[model samples]
Target: MELYKAAMVLGGVGDALGYRNSRWERCPSGVAILSELKALGGLEGITVSADEWPVSDNTVMHIVTAETLVSDIWSLTDLYREMVKAYVEIVEQIHKRQPDPATIEGCSQLKPDNYLLGWHTPFNKKGSGFGAATKAMCVGMRYWQPEKLDNLVEVSIECGRMTHNHPTGFLGSLCTALFASYAVQRKPVVEWGREMLKVLNAAETYCRKTIRHMAEYQESWFYFETKWQSYLEERGIAQEGQNTPKFPKIYNAEERDQVYREWSSEGVGGRRGHDAPMIAYDALLSVDNNWTELCNHAMFHGGLGGATGSIAGCLYGLLFGMVDVPKGLYLNLEFREKLEELAAKLHKAANEGEAV
Candidate 1:
């Protein structure tokens, strides 16, 4: 079965691999053409384009997340501080590299233009503002520090609002961060997945379905949010029957599904778009007690969508122990072993009831 732990690594792999094939330009008709090549056969038969899917901030953001996980000593305060540090570093680079009088005209979040053209970028707007990482770390820290959960959740969003004002962007980031917090505390991912959906449903109830998370997968620029039918299939979450969306379960698909659907029916329609619970449910559904498959499936999903994919990956990491992860994937990673070792240390610390 796909454990939440393995999903962390697998999600990245899948996101990268899927992006490679589906890259932004590649479509159902054919792959994208980066550059025109001369036709060997008739001009009509010539191959004009190929495929190259490059992940955007979604992939890059995870670098920050992973860094936060490995290097911060698992301290919530340290994690939040470092997360902001990373975001600042990236934004500073963007600011430095930004074309003067940057005419970033669109409302596109996926661009340097957003940083250049957008008014009062987060770096300048908020005092001590971080991204969703703060919330995740903060809120997750809550389980261990229940009295502070509300404060952390609120403050985390305040920080996110410094840059991301949009409901989807802020809430999505917030939710993801909270989930991460849970993982850091070694919470069972399946339970975490269940809780995430519950939060969305509760938020949706009063919001009147005006908002929803559209966890999109991009193959390239311009073309956003690819269809995840096939990718879901490969990971085995494509088959939707049991109420997994509303009622996710690690051991029981039917119970998970039933609970998921029950909660979802009462949820906001718009808020259900990129239903993270779906990915969480998929992680639970894809499991076979193997634990490794969780990360594998999440990485597979990451091929479809990055943030959600990583969440799925992290969940797998949270649920099943990291030892179940494959030797090669961990060994071959860019400091893969380091991530594993850090996680192990954190896990030991958490189990030993030590707070960083």
Candidate 2:
């Protein structure tokens, strides 16, 4: 398995398993979820069939972004138009998949004429959900070059703000994309959070100078930075093996939820934009190259399982490729072929430069 293909495929796999027809995602207890997985034969015994373990809107919207990026839209204006059109089209499938409310609201307000007029969706203060982050992987894949850091930051903000106009909302998109780029570069997992903070400074510069109504969200713009800093601080404490607590081995439903919420700066685990990416980052850092532990840390945490799982799975897959992954995870995954195809195209685009 190629690196890019593994990344995208595992992303879908994570979304599927974490979702499990919304059974595991909605289940508040990690212990209970693990028990259920045991009954169903665990990761090796379970197949990621669409009928049983179908992916939610997390993977669906991700593919939408990947498809639009690969299309023959070279310029930013044209790219935004194509992306908006593709996002609008996904509304047809929203009923089948449980979508984020921010996604639905933002996509509903998009119009073809708006993109043509050099405008995106209106400012959405309440749009600080993880929906935009879910589809940001390909943006990183497309511009995953050191020289293209400016392009990556700019384009990520544009795509993120297309729907989530608030800084907190769109910055989650930026973090997801930026981390994917870092993964492709094979940067150390421990360095990712710190590196992301440095990149956040760059992102803040861009937002302050470029966004038309930056002042509206300026107050909350640092929300993301604060959250990342907190995560890094906690990580540092854990690395030192100090009195800082480690992730608990067992918990009831409410206890599990409370622990994760406490882990989140946003007080909601992976439910919001700030916490989802952070949770995924934490998952990537916690696992010592163990795929199943990766699954446990990323998904079964009584949060937005699909979103965090996809983000973490994609990063882990990109970093390690498919050598260590269980075969059953991808053997029956939905749209496996299509994911590989897109991965190849995205890899080519990232390496050889985007199509002109």
The candidate that wins on TM-score is 2
lDDT of each: 0.36, 0.80
* Candidate 1 lDDT over residue span 216-253, tens digit each: 21112111012123323334333433223331234242
Question: How do all models score by TM-score?
Answer: 0.47, 0.92
Clashes of each: 43, 0
lDDT of 2 by residue, 232-317 (tens): 77556323233233555654445646767886655657877788888788777767577888888777767788889899888888
Best by lDDT: 2
Model 1 accuracy (lDDT, Cα): 0.36
How well does candidate 2 score on lDDT at residue 13? Answer: 89
TM-score of candidate 2 against the unseen true structure: 0.92
